[model samples]
Structure formats: structure tokens, C-alpha cells
Target chain A: MPDRVLRLQRIARATAVRAPARRPVMIAIAGDSAAGKTTLSGGLATLLGPGRVTTICVDDYHRYDREERRKLPFTALHPDCNYIGIMEQHLQLLATGEPILKPVYDHRTGQLARPELVCPGDFVIAEGLLPLHTKLARACFDIAVYLDPPEEIRRRWKIDRGVGKRGYDKHQVEAELQRREQESADFIRPQREYADVVVRFAPISEREDPPGTPLSAKLLLRPTIRHPDLSKVLAGDRRWTIHLKLDREENGRPVDALHIHGYAPREDSQEVEKAIWAQLGLEPGDPIHTLGHLANGERSEPLAITQLILLYHMLDESR
Target chain B: MPDRVLRLQRIARATAVRAPARRPVMIAIAGDSAAGKTTLSGGLATLLGPGRVTTICVDDYHRYDREERRKLPFTALHPDCNYIGIMEQHLQLLATGEPILKPVYDHRTGQLARPELVCPGDFVIAEGLLPLHTKLARACFDIAVYLDPPEEIRRRWKIDRGVGKRGYDKHQVEAELQRREQESADFIRPQREYADVVVRFAPISEREDPPGTPLSAKLLLRPTIRHPDLSKVLAGDRRWTIHLKLDREENGRPVDALHIHGYAPREDSQEVEKAIWAQLGLEPGDPIHTLGHLANGERSEPLAITQLILLYHMLDESR
Candidate 1:
């Protein structure tokens, strides 16, 4: 037997779970349903390369199916409606770079399906409704992000994504959103306080952009974790590209808010990407084109820049 | 948080999976289809009581469903038909008293069903067709048992079990049995070499018993593990109930052959039970009547004694 497996045997006999020497870096991308979490996590995973990244949707731990949740008084976002203990346990396992047989909550059927065996790789992107639900689950991540799109944008995205496709209508989704609002407020949004980065993608309210323009991105980078030095990206002659300003949060703590315009010229976004990519000390070529693709085949420069920064964090941690 | 969970947290940060202080006792009851693995394991689990035993069927790790297997050349019994690595991984996890979301193979619909989360209790009964098929899987158990019902009896049990209920005609079932026999010989029966106990329930060939007579049991207890001393049960005037004698295995090695007659009177089997129960030193109340029950409600004295001896092994392990 290989020495690693033999070590595992010794650990099992010792009545203790000992892991291998290599541990994967953990990243959490948390947000409400239809919050573009899939887009972000999938993009990051793609950049990390196949078999080198394990993408875990923590929602697979839901305690009930969609129909079952309809019967309960609370929404699925509530901690009581999911197997948080199992989530915490699995997170702990993955954090230690071990394998897990993760449950598959099939969204197409609105039910839980057979699980699949998942072995963690060099990086794990655990994205879903409640990956950041508990303190224990939160502690597993080296980088935590919360998607905080304004309520109106999120509502529009939900309606646009589900209407006529999920057997849901505009009014029904609106009502469902209204019903979930309390649990969302009580459980989901509060996770933003713990995130190292908070991202909001929406149209600047004062501007009336063209109908087809992508939403811009505003990332509030907290000092909780060492973030990439965006000084060069925000440096000279980049006013048309991005703006970095100090902003006071509700708790009166100042945070660095890095804003990137969705309508920035392709050259400007690529230039910004090059700056961050350079700091990562990669060999020549940039993996820029692989980062910001939406599932529907549309592209967003703001989304690309957001992923680049996250990619930087993951690479920095690995280094 | 408890001190144990705190220890787990530390292990995770250290990039290794160090387990808690306690581990489960693993028992492998391996046999062919309809060869009484479930009956034996269920009886022991019932004796052990609720929330203290996790029953795992290694068949859950099958790589293909019944429909999918129809197009393949090999029987489901072949090692190539299942996820052996995942099965071994889960067994290691359970052996260390951890939790796993085990896959589910639904026999009724001949399809794979959703998986479930399984937490190991103090005792884990991992009974299935191929649990002891590999050196790795065999190494996970503290006590290994192989059910070796005579070929005639196993065939009869399969036919009786499948004939009207499973949409199986007598001819079709016989053909299936003939088909599985090669794989059974190649992969299944060979596992007996690795078991601590080899149990075979069959009527003695020389005796012409009446129709519907319960089968007697012959247990080949190997010295791979310390078995409880059955001197008192075989001592004195209990010859009519059970016979213990020195036997030579096919390998020409000495083994203890413990035979209990199914036709023995209830009081005689009860005497054998008391002897083993006294050795276990459990609660004062005997839990005797609870053993030896078939799913259809028939009772077998020989079966009860077999369970009693296994129960002793498990309780002894915990001690």
C-alpha cells in the first residue's frame, strides 16, 4: 500500500481521523437563490482547471424538498430547514482535504437525488444558500464572499430566470419572494457581516444606460483578509476603467469599495486583468477570457474583474 | 463546543482529518443473495438496540443500475460493477466512527435512488455481497462472517425468495442462479477464506428429515479473533442441543466446529443462550426471545444460538 493510505489506516485504528499532508484552499460564495453564485463559482472553478477544483453547493444539505418546504412555516433559507450539522461536518472534512459523499439536491425535480462521492482537490469553491450559515461552516473558508445585489435587481433576476421555465409565473415568483423575504432577512443577508468581500452588481440608480448594457460591480473589500493590492489597477489614467474610494459602513467602519464599470472598454478591463494577473506571478499567458462567462453565453467585464480578484486570493493562499 | 469537536477543528486547520476519541466496532456479515445475511444482521442489530448500530449495505456503491447492467457482460456481483474505492473509503470513515452520505441502490425499481446520511453507532453491521471481497474492505472489520449455506439450500432459498414476488418465473430464476454461480465462485465464495466465522445452515445430508423441518446450523469458528468460551453450553448434558468438537478445515488447520440443532427443544436452545449471555455480562434480563426470528415470523433455535454467539462477540468487543 502507498504510504499515505497506510497513514490513513493507522489514523483509523487510532480512533482518530487523520488527513493527508496536502490541504485544499477553501472559498465560499454565498447569496440568495438566483444570485449568480453559480456563475461566479463556476467561473472560478474553470480558471482553477478540471479535477483541480471541487465545487460544493452547500444547499445539498436542505432538510426538505421544495414541496416539503411549502408545507413548513419557514422557508428553505432558515437554518432549521437544513442539515447544518452534516454541513458543518462535511465542510470540516473538505477543509482538511478529505473526500465526502455529497448529497445532490436536484433543482430540476425539486427533490434530493442520489449522492456522489467527491474528493477535494487543490481548491474547493463551496457556494450556495447557506455555506456561511453557521460559525463552524464559516470557519472552514479561507476566503468568504457574499453577493449583495439590491433587492430590485435580485427580484428581477429571479423572475427572469424562473418565469415560464420553472412552471412559475411573474406574479407567483413575486409572491414567493415576498414570502421568503423574512427568512432571507433573518438568515441569509446577515451572513454579509462575516464576508471578507461583499459584491453588488446593479445599474447605478442615477444613470439611464442602454437596455442591453451589463450591470456594473461594486466590491467592498474588508480588511478581514489580505486582499490584492488594486493600487495599480486604480492607478494613473484609469478613471474610465475603475474607481476606488473609502466608504463608511453602517457600523461606521471604513471599507475600501472598488468599483468597475460594466461599460468599460474591452481594452481597459483587459488592462486591469493584466495588472492583477501580473501580481499573481503566473507564467506569461492570461486566463482572462475564461473567467466571466454567464451560463446563457453572455459576457460581462465586471464579472470577469471580480473573478480575477478572487482568483488572486486563491492563488495567494496557495503560494 | 465539546472538547472533541474542538479537537476536530484543530485537525482540520492542520490539513489532516484526525478523528474523535471513539471508533465503532465493525461487523461484516457477507453472503450470497437470499442466503440470510439480512436476517442474521437484523437480529444482531435488534439485539444491539436503536441509535447504537449503523447498518450499511456495500451494494449501495454499485456503479450501474439494473437497467444499465443489462447491457453489460458482467453480473452485479463482479468487482468491476461497483465503486470499490468509494466503498473502501466509506468503510474507513465508518470504522473511525464518522458520518457518510452513502449512495442508495433501490432494488424494487431496479434503479439507483437518492442517498442518505449515515452516522456510525457504537456497532456497525456492514452486510452485503462483496464487503469482504477485497483485502482493503476486509481490513475494516473487527469481526468478519461469511454465510456458507450449502449450494442446494442457497438455490432453494433464492427460488423461494424470488419466485412470485420479483416477477421471476421458476425457470428464469433458475437460469439467473446458474448465471450468478460462476461469479459467485470467482468472487463471492472465496471471501470465506478471510472471515473470522463461517456459518452454514443446512440439514445434515445423511438424515432424512420430514418436509418443512428447520435446518440445523454448523458454525466454523476460526481463531482469527478471540471467541467466547462455549464450554459450559457444550459441557454437562447439553449434547442433544449443541455439539462442540475439534474439526480439521480444508486447509488442514484445526478449527472449532460448533453445531446446534434446529430441531432441538426450545429449553435446550435457551440453555445455550444463557451460557453465552452470561459471558456477555449485559443487563440481567436475557433478550433471548428477540433473536432467531425470520421476516415471515418463523423461529429457528439454531438461528437464535448463532445470533447469541455473534452478539457475544460484539459485546465483548465493546468491553
Candidate 2:
């Protein structure tokens, strides 16, 4: 109970420490592992140009590394398995446009690596499994996002990354995922409600898309904060590529659901991107050309559009 | 310059957060490696009673594990080799009677281990190589102590601990100490100037003491903070076990140097302890009997007296 109260007080202090004249616009992209958080964060950082954005992985605050975690009863998804307090403290520091010496966890080698000094830039993007896990952490962000990929799709992505890159076998990956299911459901998924934007990147279920087709993004923009007038710029999709519809929330409140189709043409998305960039009070000369490059050297127009929408919030908040 | 200024501001915040009804009194015991830091800190914790004190070794904030450090040009004593920024921040947090998820650097295995939650109790003793290395960090403590051992004794102590317990050969320990000497002089020794009390434990020079004789202590009580009225307490030292002398600082400023002899019997030292404990407004029972227990199962009367003086300062600040 004391910890809870202490955290509450710290949250108040975190919100109150906005005195820095050029504080970073803090953004959180929180999701379960393999939920496209890194991809989205990287795209945004690239879009903002060199040194304009500092990206942090809250997973670095893991209480245990991969090897030691195997001995634990719970997976990393459990809040107990991570240093949530340190993550919250670092978030509070960075949100105030201050610096932090953040811990490092090496996912590939399953070891805790050396820490690094992180100085906030014009924008700070914090992405990890639990950036929005606690209210204290979420309170430190100017905008919070949650990735909500379909379970099946996220499983496939995890297996591919775990086996192809992280030196884990398919069975181990599957078993770990199974062990984490309850935790993810209990802890990770619940954070979506706290996010201002919930992004689900998956193939359109109704479409008979081929294996190589790009994934679409469904973004639920909550009214907890003001969002971009995306409808104004996205009125002409030419092919019904981008559309916004008024959706009802769980509490019967009207929310905005902006869908960007997988097959959005580069030219059409660029038109919309240019419009959003111009809204930032800057010249829209290819401002966000590098918004959606996937690790496998593929392009996803939906990812680009989603990033631009987030970028719009980032710039809008700074104004 | 910005980091220094930021640290300064946070230091102010740290000191200003004394509104808690039971804020922990912070004390720092800083010195080079194998400087009896853990031993001193453990004794202080024991004397303070169970659960009433929290001991923190700031060395846990090491930026790199021992293996990685071997490849670096500087030793762990170098400020850059540790997370000085995070250490300062965590000190600020803990000094404010707040909880912190502190990182762990395992000296035994030379690996970065899992962090632990530290909740400040009635007393917080932070002992490490660099707790007083920065002015900002030093400002968080109510009482600051620097352990200054003669080079020969410190070397022997390090080699003994390193080779016997930490799995290092004598040659390796000596080589590492040689590599660290420059950094120790440049970074570690300079912190002594920032301390309110400097403690030097060594054999009484020119005395015909045997090898088994416990080391005596010479405490330079700088006027940066008020010192207990030891002259009053030592009006009758029986056999001159404890004495207070007017000392001169480098700039001819008057300082107090209290010297306690190793040959002082336990009974005489207890008298001094009783006097100091009475000053704390507590009943002088066996309040400080557990102090000065060395690692080799031996006890030192001088150590007991040193800890009692420090406790006087800590309790006085709380009052």
C-alpha cells in the first residue's frame, strides 16, 4: 500500500515537472513481445531525422535475463520479472527532457549488458513490453500507444524472430509463449485501455490476401487527448485506402477508428503524409519518406500511415 | 555543463524532500576497493537494529561487468566506468526516503546480476568507491565519511580478499591495483575533501604492536558539520584509550582529530560509546556492542568508537 501511494505521488510529480522549455515529447509504444513495437518506434525515429528522436526499450529493465528467467515460475511478461520501478523512474526523468543512464538487457545473448546514457532529444520514443504497464509509467508520456496484433500473427512473428535470429528453437519459443499467455492476458493486454492509440497491425481478415500481402492497421484513437484531424487530409483515398469511422467504446463513448488498408499506394499515402506534415507548420518536402521500412526489407503502407498519424500527435503536442 | 547543472537542481530537490515523518538519515562511506566498506556498513546496520537500517553499496551501479572492464583502458574506480548519472539519481531518490529498484553488480562472479528493491528505513548507509565522487551525490547524505587507509595496508587487504575469496590470484590482484592507482588518486582520493569526516585505520606508527594487534583509527572531524563534544566525554579515559586533540588543516584551519588506540580495552571504549549514545537521547544499554567486528572473527575497539561517533551525527541530524 505504501508503494502504491508512493507511486501515486510520483505520478503527480512526474506530471508537474514540465518546466523545461524544450522538453521532449514523450511517446510510449507498449505491447507484448513481438508486437511490432520496435518496428513502429524505429520508423518514427527515422521519420524524425537524425538525433531528433531517442528510442528506449523498457525491456532493458528486466529483473532477470533470458537464462535466469527460465528458472522462474513466471515469464518476463509478469510484472514481477522486471524492474518496473526503475523503468518508471527513467521514464519520469526522460519525460522532463532530462537524461538517464538506462540499464541494458541483451536479448540475443541472454545477458545483462552495460548500461548507457540516454539524453532526451526533441522527441523520445520508449517502446517495450511494459512501458504502459503501470499508471505511474503511463503518466510520464505525452502520448501512449499499444500494439494489439492478433494472437496468431504475433505468435508467428515471435517464432520467426526467436528461431531465425535469437538462437531459440521453435519448440522453446512455443513453450515460452504458452507460459506467457496468462501473464500477457492479465498484464500486457490490459494496458491497451490506458493508451491513447491502440494499433492493431494484421492482415485484413475478410480479404483473400496472398502470403506476401502487406498487413493493414486498425488504429483506435481515444479521446483522452486531442488527435489529429486525419479525416480532413484523408478524405480522398482515391481507392478507399484510408477511412475514419466513429466507433463506440466499451463505455458507450464515441471513439475514432482510423483504418489504413494494406494496399494503400505509396503515392496516395505520400499525399496524406504530406498533408499531415504541413499541419506541423513545416514544409512538407518528403518529411516522412522513411516511415515504414520493415526488417525484411519490405514496405507496409499501413505502417507508414500509422507512424505519420503518431508523428502528427507528437508535433501537435509540441505546439 | 548541463548534466552538472541538472544534477545540482536535483540535489536541491533531494535535500528539500524532508517532509516525511520518518525520513531515513543517509550516510555515505566511500573509499577504494577492499577498503572495509562492506564490513563497516554491516557493523553499522547491526548496531542500528534489525530492519531499522538499509545498507547500499553504490558499486552496484557499475556500467560494465568485470569481463568487459578488463578490455577498457580505465578501471572500475574511474567515474566513466560506472553509471555516475544513475547513481546520483538513485541516491537522490533513496535520500528522500523513497524506494528504488537498484542495479546489482556481483563482485564475486564479475557479472551484472538482478536488481533488488531498496526501501529506506530509519537509516540508509551507502558505501562504495564513488558515493562521494560527485558534489551532487555527496549533497544527498546527512553524514559523509571517507575511509583512508595507508597504501601498503590497503594493498595487502585487497590482495588478501581478492585471492582468498574472489578467485583472483595475487599477481592478478596486484596488477589490477596497479592499473587502478592512477584513477584512485585522480577520482577516488579527491572525494576525501568532500567528506565531513575522514577515517584512517592503521597501526599506531612507531608503536611496538604485534601482528595480532587490531588497527587503531584516526578520525579527522572537519567543521563542515558539527562534531560531538568528545572532549567532554573523554574527560577521564582511564588509560588514555581515547583522546581529543586540536588539529590543523592544510590551510591552517582548526580541525578536530580524535584518535582511538587499538590497544584500548573493550570496557574503556564502551564508556565512550555510552557517552555518545546518551547524547542521542537514548538509554545507553548495549546499544553499540556489535560494532567493529572484522571479517576474520576479530573485534576492534577503535572501530566501535568510530561507528558510535558517526551514529551520533546521524541521530542528531534526525532530531
Candidate 2 residue pairs in backbone clash: none
Off by over 4 Å in 1: A1-8, A11-22, A205-213, A252-254, A281-287, A295-297, B1-8, B11-22, B205-211, B282-286
**True contact recovery of candidate 1:** 0.29
**How high is the lDDT of residue A41 in model 1?**
86
Q: Tell me the TM-score for chain B of model 2.
A: 0.90
Please, what are the lDDT tens digits per residue for candidate 1 over residues A179-293? 9999999999999999999999988666787888788999999998998877777887987778888999999998999888887787888788777777778755746678889
Clashes of 2: 0
- Point out the worst 10-residue segment of candidate 2 chain A by lDDT: A1-10
Interface RMSD score of candidate 1: 7.5
Pick the DockQ winner: 1
> lDDT per residue, candidate 2, A226-275, as tens digits?
88766577666444678888899888988999887786667787676666
Worst 10 residues of 1 chain B by lDDT: B12-21
How well is each residue in B84-138 modelled by candidate 1, as lDDT tens digits? Answer: 8678878877776667778899877878877777889999999999999876677
Q: Kindly give the stretch of ten consecutive residues in candidate 2 chain B with the minimal lDDT sum.
A: B1-10
Q: Candidate 1, after superposition: displacement of residue B197 in Å?
A: 1.6
